[model samples]
Target: MTSLPEDPSSPIGESARDTAVRRLQEAFSEGHISHEELDGRLHWALTAKTHGELVAALAALPAEKAGTTSTIAAAGGQIRRRGAWQVPRTLKVASAFGRVRLDLSRAVIEHPVIDIELQLGTGRAHITVPRDAIVDLEGLHTGWKDLRYKTRRSSRPGGPTIRISGMVGFGRLKVRHARR
Candidate 1:
């Protein structure tokens, strides 16, 4: 068992703490821990004093395995990934003067989290996920672009997490909620 710091007030740098939180989120998204378990550990991690304390929060989770990726090119009219098709752990979407849409409300997903890379130029991308799923748009670059989503819904734990990246220029990217 990892021991707590001798001094609780000792500063645990924000970067280190952020890394720990990311690790915890990864574990949660990989189905290694339940939402309740993640919530409990997240509280502990947030109040931790040392790196060891943060590491302990993820020590009990299962190890992750390799995942597959899928790429969708939208140079044509439109690209859609809806219905009963399988969903990859990572998705790459590239659109140039076209439209790309991914509806995950009814898609088959094996993983608890998905990583997406988008490249849009004079094009548009639309994504719809289940209401419970969390959408992380932190890595997206919206310079000279338009990004929109449903702000009325609140994301809850236990559902899949979608971490999005990439950039858009003279294009639009939007996210929405869907029920299936």
Candidate 2:
């Protein structure tokens, strides 16, 4: 409710939050963040109390670069991808003695097909997707690991597909589709 006055002289004016929101939108357009991510950030930007808070909202965004992949490296901890997250065309997830969960139930899919590369070192990865999503687990080459898929739907035209690939070392990989 409290917004700073518009000052033309200052580069950072009352529209700082608005600019931040715009940047977030751009990120979405470029397939950087999902609708849920955008919604969460836009809410924060709109409710930001100060210029710093607005800037902080934008700072949460990952650096935008062509052919770049989003990464989640969890070491001795847990990394989660749920809610509103802008998923990348190619994502790299590495976990060492930890848990990595990716929930695509409400994710915004910019690309028709998504590739996920995982490196689990005695860790666990759990992925959940929407019922309409097509999951392909053939790319995953495992060695001394456990990979499970609970997908009921096959790949079809005009539907999003998630292609999971990568290595699992004494770890667990489970992919489940959400029920409507």
Best by lDDT: 1
Off by over 4 Å in 2: 1-68, 153-157
State candidate 1's TM-score. Answer: 0.65
Model 2 — TM-score against the truth? Answer: 0.60
Residue-level lDDT tens digits of model 1 in 1-180: 123345645556777677667767777766677899889988988988766676676677655454567888867688878888888888898988888888988888778888889888887888998778888899999968569976535567677888889998788899987754
lDDT for every model? 0.78, 0.77
Instruction: For candidate 2, give the lDDT of residue 144.
Output: 88
Instruction: Tell me each candidate's RMSD, in Å, in order.
Output: 6.6, 12.3
- Among the numbered candidates, top TM-score falls to 1
Query: Worst 10-residue stretch by lDDT in candidate 1?
Result: 1-10
Q: After superposition, how far is residue 33 of candidate 1 from its true place, in Å?
A: 7.3
lDDT of 2 by residue, 1-180 (tens): 134445423334456666677568777755678889889888987877766666667875766446636887978799898987888888999998999899998887786667899888887889997778888888898778667886583544556778898898888888998765
> In model 2, how many backbone clashes occur?
4
